[model samples]
Target: MTRRYCSLPRQSVPAFTPGLAAERLGALIGGRRMWVNGTVLHYCFLEADTDASVIPVPGTGETRRVPWAGAREQLDVVRECFREWQDLGIGVTFAEVSDRCEAELRIGFQLGDGSWSEVGRDALSVGAGERTMNLGWDLTEPGGRWTALHEIGHALGMRHEHQSPFAGVHWDDEAVYADLAGPPNHWSRDRTDASVLRKLDPAEANGSVWDPQSVMQFPFGPGLILEPEQYHNGLYPPGSLSPADKEFVLRWYPPADVPAPLVPFRSAPLGLGPGEQADFTVAPLETRVYRVGTFGESDCVVVVFEERGGEPRYLAGHDDGGTPHNTGLRVRLVKGRRYFVRVRLHSTWGSGETAVMCW
Candidate 1:
């Protein structure tokens, strides 16, 4: 018998504006959201001895463990990919079980939360120093390595590569994601909310160009599998990490403090003298950018600077939690000749009315 799959509703195209350069820039810079500190993650692994037609997961329950032969090999592959981050002085350790550590990362076989598709469930769960990752067994099938890598990227707080600045080059949303998979299933208000937060979080980087070969990217579409230039019989072959991917891993996950260029922007500022704060706006000239959270959330802020003659110059500084309806910056300016000032805003999943001040 032929298997049947549920088809999702079509998505509406984002209306394109003619000359909203800042909006465009915001989209670009916003694509590279960062993770936050004191953020913990949990991952669960499920194994089935017999290659069952499907895997099962409880919709709401503590993580469980199963047995499978491919678990170690799969873990090794993930470790190899993550080694790059480790080298970058980023801390990523593994624990035996969910309770063993404050944060958990789960992996398993099959698809769905036993109700719908596995990928459809929340891929990452964020809590106070705790988050969770669910890696389904379906990803262990032959040729599913790319999916494995992509999900791991999410576990590491990385967003979809298609959301990257270089997304224009690789993304053919209509063709590639025509039959998209998993929950947060289609782009809805909830999905948009998550995307907005992921984009602005300070732990994410800003101004970094999207690396097409980053393991975080999907390998089945456009330049990824089928290069626009090298069309092979109207079909594109699967793609993997390029030299750049290896380099990024090595550099990002350095064993020590990697002497990398300073990220061009800043998060919202803090510790303002009573009644003294900075105000700004969210404007992306040619890139997608976000404002880090301040006030009620994390304490970090983001700022952007321009070079003036020989010294770096400040353009703007933003404060957190002024108001949500307005994305403009609001802070007290001190007696100083700053180059310029602007503010950016980002949204979090459960936290309401958070702000990040940036210049």
Candidate 2:
């Protein structure tokens, strides 16, 4: 039997009403970004010597101490995965950081905790010093490598492909629970249900065709899939990212071609559709505090990055999720330094062309 495992990309937010859930999941659908103002995200792992499981085992205080050897292997795989995704030229970029204070994606490798990551920007809501991603199983093996890819997809705001509304997969819930309880997974019934069995709302599925081979898909075993009869025997996603995954990411975060320039104290029309973002290069005249904000009643995510040696570094970000007020970020800007502001519109209410200004 294959040593199968699963990636549980759980939401940081607890259960809520369906309407609110979709509303929240909507932002993630567009990609759970750290304000995706096209900032370069930095990921770091907990020190193998100091960090322990953030979630205590429900009963026993027994926690895992990630082995440095395996953690080292996991780190190499993650770096490769980061470059793989980066090579695609998608809206995302990543860099490894040593300090947790400077990292947005804080990864932990506590064995027995099971593999998982909080979806997208939800990482921000996590406690300042908590693990946002985990790799419980050894990742040196070929099969285990996929877990890193899948969890990173989650961190980028991708949902489970098997749960896609268009997937048309009918799961044998009992069989799923029983199978996951053994060997590689060892997930409890609740974990299985939460990560695998639950179907997503169509709105959250991005209205795309189901791609069984997507890296975001879990490996389904025989007797686990009972629908779409052709796959009834089993469903196995290609261990690597699929073509569909690439296309979807590219479409959502299409290249800016050339970013627009936004002058200080001058407003620029976003003229962006919902789920769309605009990028601008902002060069300040003096070294001082600068404020960037979007006007009009809208839901937006605003992020500012400092251009350093051709790489953009995340500096500040803010999100207004379907709120009455606009979103803004204030930061100290230095003269002779190049900066950029990325603003994504979630939705505009009672208005047309949301505009942003830096002052």
Candidate 3:
């Protein structure tokens, strides 16, 4: 039987789930790395020399430093993907940087390394001067666009749609293991389990209905999923961002600029629904440690950014982060310095129940 190499894009979840994701945690420019709406994140490409050519071996606790093997002819594909995502009109902005030391995303293209990316805020934790993303194959191929989009989605905090708890996919484990063990993938049983067979924690799932065409899904050929019988033949996404993908991101990262008017010491109501955010600008009168906190019963994350040269610089972060406690953080403020507090709610008990205050 002729194997399909196209299905073997070899795309993995970069470290927040596996590794580049983990890489992001240390590489963060500022001490904090929360995805506050309207924040600007920069990405840089790895060139020859230093750790630019290093690839961390996933699950083996090892790494390899070798010459870059990327298909330079299609070099601009990643940037193109970022542009397409920006065209979606989300609040967060993406920029390219020449220095890896100053970038939130350090990408590499070592041949045979397989395509993967850092997931979300973890990009901040990536070791300084290390690569947090990689692409092994040429992005000019048929599935290349989707691969880039999918990996970027991960970097932006989107998890695998197939791993969604709402997705009722029951896999025929043996068939999946056999298929992935062959050409292009050669994944071991453990690797296959971690990538395809494993299910995500329900808490991590974004709680949306499974959109089969989500670009953040793995292309499982026919006869892999035994349950959800509709997918028994195969579950191949259309190789593009789905409507849900755009909607999900848009809800979390709105297009309109969030103002900083809800001043310090004044409790302001967060007039947002699920997946909505509020930005509060604070102008400190004196240098001191201050506390910002959310009141009443609500689930949210709070990120603080200092305005530096017209850009928001990360300062600190705190969150309910899936626990019962409301989010709060204590950050030092410099006299006359302007700062912004971004609060995003995952869910709230009632319309007027959630509010935040800084003092």
Candidate 4:
């Protein structure tokens, strides 16, 4: 399918209702905490008495200091925020790492200017297995607290909340684009501003339809300065979370599943070189546990193939129980070598763990 993109501006406050519900469900499923697989976070500490508004950027390899009280307060709030997710089954926690921190699972913090933007340069450097959140020195200042939360969301690997699928309901694409374009980062591309809209995983498409009220969502614009109608419920700030957004986060990434593994178990290839042909088979560890068939009649297996890079190519296979209990597939590989395969065991309950194989 062709990738669909949406044009929307980022919001300051992310929607929270959907996330709340997802947390509830996760707790019921497995007693284990949901893990956020990839992320590396860092924070800068400041003194409580220091002026956060005029904070200066920290020099490289230097730790800007924050008032003991201020740092403690911010950390407390942050800890509490993550605790909420943890309670829901998401496994979000904090750790202390110095410069030795690496990408796999390392994060560090430094105290410096929050307004200068540059001070938090690597603040968004989260990768697989690591995520980062920043605590600006001026967080105690008015509006600064919200900024800290917004940045933290990013540190948690969430794109602007406004990018939620439901954003199309409230956003006036042309108007918002006119205002957001022509900056250090132009919001021209449909996918540029709306990170939530992007397809991070195929499951998201099947799960909740779409929601705009997720706490991970961004507001129409900063609280003031730009009072777009979407910001409020026709006339006032619409504070309630959207059903879809709330359901999405809460259901997908519950607090109990903090540090959850967000890896793609099953993946299709992008492109394959011309005249190339590949075939493979996988046997279920326990065959009797899973029966394959449309409606309990005959046994069968399903195979799916897709081209990744050059052009979109796909195929599927169904094998009768006669063939050594294994299903096979063959495809004509195209130039550019971008292709992958995925296998599914369709049963009465539901599909699980799409076994992915590539060549």
Candidate 5:
């Protein structure tokens, strides 16, 4: 069979507006619509300040229940994406299993419109009827296929490529605001800032360099970018995953390696207060990005260290990340080394809880 490439127009393409979809699902500036544990959590609120009034759930609120018939067709596409991940050694699986079976993640359309998936392991937080992924729209073409792969990328713990702090793409902010606020996406200033202008922190930087052609990246169209001749006109249609996409999956989800923890090392719901810190130890393992985040309203700072002779040696530290200032760090730990993780409160808030995770 011949392949159909994603040919979303440079402007006014609704299907290409995944960020807008996320905004519609109640993800405010710097706040995640979905939460991460060892799996994705959909139809559930993770942060304290999240607005629950608009969340779509069956027989609740004013939103329509998911049309499972349509959802099943989309599941076929999701399975294809899963197969690709499995082929690349990422140990994730997607299928229509019995509701009684204990599964890591459950995806459906019990939420707001468009295609969206919780980042990585946040999916484990929902109930059977609730969805960890939503296909508010239908999957009818090759673009649907690309959408499936892009969302599954999130399911695999990868973030938006354009948000990479190192991408360095000079966005024409005013033009971006103007363009996105009209036509298909009538995003507000805060949503625009969070979705388009917000850059991932240096600590969240993964892979070697930015992959503009990555499926996780949204094409900016003409006049949206102002730097790097390679990106001034926006990227060509991301019909499929770039080489780096595959490499990232293989590197993070090596089949031979033991699976990382399914749950967080700690769940600090109240958060660390002023001058407060928490410590944890890591086992011997190759270097990879470990995430530390506030489930509540506190800003967080994380420091990684190696214990030596009744002392501590610093290895890595990060303050803000994602659009919300969550923290992430990539570090290498020795097998028997006792590592101390110091989680500190960075906001004026008195106290906030945190969750530390590795995968």
Candidate 6:
């Protein structure tokens, strides 16, 4: 059976024995929080003094940064991808064409040796010199679009397909470790375990059909797994998103037929002071959970109120009793209603950073 593995280009090869190479790869790939097998994502918190709470553009006052010389053209590709996904019934909005961070999703490519991105709401935690998404290659390269879509997939909360609990692949562990440790991949045993062998929880399958051709899948040659015939040496190339991929995305982010009742908040770390209040209108959804959280020592409280006939009625309130040490609350919301989320710092602790979102 043939097995496919992630190999480094010959020109980038390092001087090291197979065992040593394997150890290094394992450390680099497995030792951090990741969106996929090899993609590393970091946690960045909003600064204590920032007025806005949603992930802000790295610099102050709407100024933005670009990754490279052709960043403008590259952004077109990203915007088009968002449009494609939206056309397929996904709920996503891309900013108007420009060379800056005027949208919810901002990615700046800096000098780097690899690609990485934060998953979903984690993008809010991005820091300076760090991006929600980062790329080492230029958009003109052969795998540029594939790389963008792949990282964006992570941004959308998708994980590696190989790790799906439903994917019934059997790895030839010995061969996989040997190949990755020897050349381009030079992955350590633990790295190999996390990337190629670890399985996601069964609940993550989301009832969709399993697809080996997913863009999230990594190429593995023969002998890496027990059933070579069943698993193609290179199951799927990194070109277009597979049919299952489309279905999966749509399922998670279906089309929104109604305009949002209020403008979605984009500022990071909505720093609420004592008794401070913020109002947000919840748009229609079949069902949704709203999460409110804090970053510092301030004890935060949340109260959900629904406006009926122009009068406010309290629905629920969360105090320090909730899990995660009383710094957050999870509230379920109904459709097509204007709900106000009042957030404030509890007594004793005067002020701190807070965040609110729904999914």
Provide TM-scores for the models: 0.41, 0.86, 0.79, 0.37, 0.53, 0.53
Instruction: Residues 111-137, candidate 1: write the lDDT tens digits.
Output: 332111112112322332222333444
Please give, for residues 55-87, the per-residue lDDT of candidate 6 as tens digits: 336566574333332356665666566556556
What are the runs in model 2 whose C-alpha is more than 4 Å off? 7-9, 13-37, 54-71, 308-310
lDDT tens string, model 4, 249-353?
A: 454343331111112223432121111122332222321222222222212233333333322223334432222233444444444343333222211112332
Model 2 agreement with the true structure over 123-149: per-residue lDDT tens digits = 777775788888777788767778888
Quantify all predictions' global Cα lDDT against the true fold.
0.35, 0.76, 0.73, 0.33, 0.52, 0.50
Poorest lDDT segment (10 consecutive residues) of candidate 2: 12-21
Best by TM-score: 2
- The model with the greater lDDT, 3 or 5, is 3
Off by over 4 Å in 4: 1-73, 91-137, 142-152, 155-157, 177-207, 221-250, 253-359
User: Whole-model lDDT for model 5 versus the true structure?
Assistant: 0.52
- Compared with the true structure, model 5 gives a TM-score of 0.53
Which model is ahead, 5 or 6, in terms of TM-score? 5
Give the candidate number with the greatest lDDT: 2
lDDT per residue for candidate 5 within 1-359, as digits (tens), equals 22222211111111222343332222222222121111211122111222122435557556632343344566667677667756665423333334422334455443234456666534444454444555545565646777777776776666777778888888889988887777455567776776568786553444559887787777667777898776777665565888898877654443332222223354534333432344455554544445544454444556665666544444666655323446677766665566656554434332434565543
Give Cα distance to truth, residue 66, candidate 1, Å: 12
